[model samples]
Target chain A: MSGFLDILYFIVPISIAYAAPLIFTAIGGVFSERSGVINIGLEGLMVMGAFVGIVFNLFFVDTFGDWTPWVSILVAMLVSAIFSLMHAVASISFRADQVVSGVAINLLGIAIALFSVKMIYGKGQTDFIQEKIPRFNIPFLQDIPVIGPMFFKSVYGSSILAVAIAILAWFIIFKTPFGLRLRSVGEHPMAADTMGIKVNRIRYIAVIISGGLAGMGGAVYAQTMTNDFGHATINGQGFMALAAMIFGKWHPIGAMGAALFFGFAQALAISSSGIPFMQNVPSVFLYILPYALTIIALAGFIGKANGPKALGDPYIKGSR
Target chain B: MSNRLINVLVPVISIILGLLVGAVVMLVSGYDPIAGYIALWNGIFGDSYAIGETIRQISPYILAGLAVAFAFRTGLFNIGVEGQLIVGWFAAAYVGMAFELPKIIHLPLALLAAAAAGAIWGLIPGLLKATLKVHEVIVTIMMNYIALHLVNALIKVVAKGGFKTDKIQDTASLRSDFLSELTDFSTLHYGIFVALFMVFIMWFILERMKLGYELKSVGFNENAAQYAGMSVKKNIVMAMVISGAFAGLGGAMEALGTFGNMSTRAGFTGIGFDGIAVALLGANTPLGVVFGASLFGSLKYGANNMPNAANIPIEIVSIVIALIIFFVACGYIIRVGLQRIGKNKEAK
Candidate 1:
């Protein structure tokens, strides 16, 4: 019992910290995918967000002081949302292949961000920011028994915010009238169109919201984990989030759960050295666990993942 | 204009627009676009050495492009091309290092090993897509990460915990001393011939074979193909395997021709991702992929000179490449714009 508790105390906080970014990003994916647009550009949007977040934090640390990370996240969100408009214009307005457009967006995001970094810093990477997101235990919550030590200690505020947002996303996606209209557009745009729900407009909103949330996720990752942005900073995290979204079957709460599972896998990989039996295990196995599990989950071990009926098909106003 | 003319015109116009946007970006960044283009040109065609190296770089790209184009022709997206290439690279290097035989047997054996490795990687996702109805995109994406980690681990085991494996024996090398001498000591090799041959092979399979017809029918309409007594699952798996074999051969070009060894990568080589752009620019055609590969290969090879010659970052080339793909993706807009231009010409 004591050994299990010790492991929990060691692993839980790290898992939550890792999961926070994935939760935000996966929820972002849920929003876009649920609206019938496959936003594979989430990776690119995250890259943009991470780049802007680090740049903003580095430049404005003197101005914003302790609030620098938060402010940078907001700015990153706005910039990333605007950046995602290119994807929207290409795929939605111009009727480009969504997957191809997303691929272009990924390449463009990394290229433009890295180019700007070199131009500004006169180097391949930027200076690390001093003001990182703070970690603290909730005052009263820390007094609770076994749970407090495992869950409340050294917790990032972003993790709590992520969980809150997931719940809020769940409410907004499933309970609201707007949610019904969004699903209707994704499921049967023609029916939704007849009922006067401006399908394209709803899709545009969903994509923008996804961008904003994914940007926030990127910013949070840069601030809390990496504390700097480089080419490798947001590597594959966006794809992992995509996996989480899929594993969760495109549901908000389910995505959060999947994110947590992936986060646990990541945490185990990082913290395996501390555990006795795991010390001898190959690190590569741990590294491959989350991805391998995703494949398994999608391979009908869990259940069939049926996406929106109209998913990946562009709506052409009146065309069948 | 004829439909065929419009099809060619769209890609051409997109390329021009892409370059124009790149020039505008250079101007915005306070750099000389003319000097950049000049440096870019010199980098690719300044001398025999540059030309040789550029073609060497293009060899793998041609195969990668073909890999993607073949899959696209079969209604599949093999995003795991990078992962397949990695495993193929390792397999070729391993076979090359482990063997001691005549050149003919050794080289073919190494190349076959690479193709098999890549095929297995692709087959897993294909099987899942066919049997379990899992989305290939997601499975391929996962497979990529798995391949990276698994290959890296295997490399360590082979190299005794080092980052790279031992260099392959001379018998298996694709490098040609005669070609290198002709190209002013550039790393040009026999891989270019192999790449071109594979291009022809892909064309033959897709255009002249019954299997190709079956695959195309499956891609075009799975239900219709099934109704017509085709095995949709088998075609899907076969298409992925063939696509993977092409990608794997791309890895052999790097292993046997250019590098002669396999090393653990810090990230993806970007070759497979760039293959997406190449396929798109090529309009997913065999001959078109050759043109796309040449353009992309030269630009990529040329990007090295931009930082020194124009005081610009090399990433600008990547930006240009990305923009080109973006324009290609938005071909509908270009078609509309061209139609408008044609109408204006008529009015005048």
Candidate 2:
């Protein structure tokens, strides 16, 4: 019985690590979508950030060694922000179709990152990181029974950060004037514009913020979870985050809940192999649980999840 | 008169600019960009073999691009082409493995099954969009994942411990090795002929058929189309079915002619998504899709050779393609450059 409990303990922490990257990204989607820019490029941006973060961490660790994670995380955020500026230029400035422009950004991001990584590394993947984040047991609290180990003892620093960021994201999305304006733009940009808000500028800010957070998510995944970078490392995580965002009904807290649920499903899928009854079930089915859940969520099985009214519609000045 | 010439020349000029950018990247990386481009050109068009490879690559693009282009003409975004392609691939492959019959019947039967499979895959999004007013983009994106996992599950069940299916029967297979004997084993098959036929059929259907007119009218404006007595819902669903059928045929070509079996590789083949770029670049016309697919195929085939010859990564080709798409989509940037050129000419 304790052995079963031990397995459960192992599953929760590892699952949370996998969920951390997605939580940040889903929150990023919340910011972008709330501001009415449908950022399909979130996937591409996360991929870019994953590559840059790992590469930066590699070099920084080669030199500074100890301060590598902080340096690499900052560099990843900066790179993602710079990368997202292209989407801003295309969608916000040029007034192109937000979805199409986002797709272009995604294509450009992946192409550029993969091309450069191949040029520098001589392959499509990067060398594994020598230094990786290890499990940290919190002082005093780790000694508690049952829930304590699952919450703090077995959890990664990045997982803790994801939860903290979720709270901060909730505060920002609901408690701030900027958040109100962002939601106003997404819900009705023309109304916000008439109210003297700089709609496009706000949208740009939202997109950039999204990119930065997603970059951090990528960095955390690299530094904490995988400790390596490859062309396929960020495969569909961004899309999964998008699904989570939709599943959670586009709210930050809701998205975090959805992310955790997805993370648990993934963890359960993998960990279930150890359970006697589920031993025969193929593990691949769990790999697709999040996506399956997304369809179910969208099909009205989860009730009506309304996106922002002005989502995906490009804003044109002086148009009705 | 010359100014009008420049307007037509701009897309060509953009292509040149994209190539030059690719060239500059190659030079910076210590490879001869000119040699790389030359090698790419040769690999795609230099000999009968290379040309056949190019055509082989373009076969699916022609169909997938048509899939996307057809939907676009109906004012629908069939982002589910990837899903449709997978279902079509599995359908064709399953039929190929399940039956043994005369070539006269098996080949056409497999092809038709592939088309019907794609059509069924496409119908889900069409129904949702037409009835529930759900966005096709989201539904299509979701369907891609569904198709991937569902097929993967099916493959696991039917493949009997192997990741791939058994080799398709000779009756079901569409090999061109015999034709290759005449053309020095160029690897081109009857698929190219089929693809070309599709181009003609698509052109005829979109131009001559009343249903096609309704689809186009709906694309332009649903209100106007409905006022013109066209059923928007029916056309939307029909457009998706036709698009799905095209993608299905594309998958059949790949399964029967190329891979000869169904297997998972890296998640999903990007060919269907790449069709989006091709259709957009080709301006979504049948002839244009062929041209765009050929261009893209040439670049991809060349990129594979570049790593061996120039020591440059194959991913740069994707970069070049992306850049070209970016430049073309930002038509205002080109117009601005053209305007400045005209002003300079006037001053002279």
Candidate 3:
């Protein structure tokens, strides 16, 4: 029984590592959609963040040493925010189709990132980072019983950070005055605008924040999940975060829970060989599990789980 | 300018702006823009072989673009075109290799199988949207990954050889020796004609049929369409099914004509994603997709030769393609800007 428990313990910490990025990105999605901007560019934004984060780490690690990954995380957020301004300008200012603008951002982000990689390294991939963000065991928490070893013995700081951010996000979104204005704009842009809220400006800020957070999510995925940056490093994680956002009913704390669930699913896929019952199962089924679950969850819960009222609509000053 | 003329100018202007962005990237990167452009042009159009290759590359893109455009016209986003295309590619390869029949029967059968596979894949998201009110965008994106992993697994189970299947039977192939000879041994095939035929089919359905009007009406205003006694849900499903058919044919073009073999993939083909840009550039019209696909194909095919000849990374071409879509997505802004300029000139 302890042996079985041991395997579970091993998988728990690894799963949290996978959950970190999803939590951050889902929170990002929540922020954007709550303000009426549907940021389908989350995937692309994640790619930009991952690429810049890894590139920054590779080039600047000598100067910053152990502080390199954290600095790179900040840089990635700024870069991704700047990059997402294109979508903001197109969707909010120019009144271009939001979905179309998002698709364009997705394309441009990956393309520019890969192009720059080639220009800098004369190759399509960035150099692998030698040092990663440090992980730790909680000093007092690890001293407890069965729960302690499974939860706190070996924990990634990034996962802890994701949970903290999700809580902070929930507080900001549900309990703050700014959140009230943001939700008002998403619910009724005309009413919000008439009542002195700057609808477009609020949308721009929300989208920019989404991009920055998504960039950090991507950076965490790179720094913790993978050591190198390439075109494939951030694949599907952003989309999965969107799935988590939807599954969570657009709530930050709920999104973190969904992310944890997905991260567990991923961990099972990766660590199935060590688990007794899962050894004979084909890995393909494991691979398809999360996506299939997302589809089912969306189909099952969407009718009850309403999104922001003006989610995909641009705020026209005179429009009904 | 007339609305039609302004509509026509959007893509043309965006293409120029996209190219200018490419030039800036090139200049900043310290490569000679003139030499790079010349190499790209020569690679695409300077020779018969190059032109043939370009056309060969474009045939699938046209079909993929049509897939995206058709759905766009019906107010549906078909991000799963990549998934549909891959499943279709696998189905075509499977039927081509697994069957024994005359050339006349075998070829069309494989293509039909591909179309069916793609249609079934597309139908799921369509049904989800109609029945559950789940957003098709989210469903399609999820379905793409599901299709990718499931098909990769299925291929491993079905294929006799290692990672790739055997060469497709000649009777099941789309390659035409006559065209290959005409194009100086390029891989150009009968797929081009089929692609043109599909364009006509899309045009006929959208322009001449009552069903087309219904689809467009639903796209323009679903509530209004429902008020007019049309089944909005059915039209939505039908549009996705039809859009998927186009993507299936594109996969057949690649499997039967270009590659003639299927290999396992760990990632998406990206042809479907590129199709989004093509559809946008083409203004969601069948005829426009042809021009859009042509430019996209020529740039992509031409870029393959640039790394060796011009010392420019091929990713620069992707940047250009992406920028084109970006500028084109911002087409409304450009249109308003243009109209303002025209008014200023009129005042002068």
Cα lDDT computed for each candidate against the true fold = 0.91, 0.82, 0.89
Worst 10 residues of 1 chain B by lDDT: B1-10
Q: Which segments of model 1 are wrong by more than 4 Å?
A: B343-348
What TM-score would you give candidate 1 relative to the actual structure? Answer: 0.98
Second chain alone, TM-score for each candidate: 0.97, 0.93, 0.98
Which residues of candidate 2, in runs, are more than 4 Å off? A1-4, A280-284, B1-14, B332-348
Screening candidate 3 with a backbone cut-off below 3 angstroms (N, C-alpha, C), the clashing residue pairs are none
Q: Write the per-residue lDDT of candidate 2 for residues A15-126, one digit (tens) a residue.
A: 8888888898999999999998888778888888888888988877878686777678778888998888887777777666666666667677778788888878878678
TM-score order of candidates, top first: 1, 3, 2
User: Comparing only chain A of model 1 with the true chain A, what is the TM-score?
Assistant: 0.97
Over A1-320, each residue of candidate 3 has an lDDT whose tens digit, in order, gives 88878887888888888999999999999999999999989989999999999999999999999999889989999999988898889889888888778888888888888888888999878888976878889898888998788888768777888999999999999899999998998999999999999999999999999999999999999999888888888888988999889888899998999899889888988889878988999777877777887788887753466789999998888867
Tell me the interface RMSD of model 3, in angstroms.
1.2
Candidate achieving the largest DockQ:
1
lDDT of 1 by residue, A215-294 (tens): 99899998888987777888888889999998899999999999999999899988999988789988889888888888
Model 1 has a DockQ score of 0.81
- Model 2 residue A167 CA deviation (Å) reads 1.4
- Residue B338 CA displacement from its true place in model 2, Å: 4.6
The TM-score values for the models, in the order shown, are: 0.98, 0.94, 0.97
Q: In model 2, what is the error at residue B45, expressed in angstroms?
A: 1.8
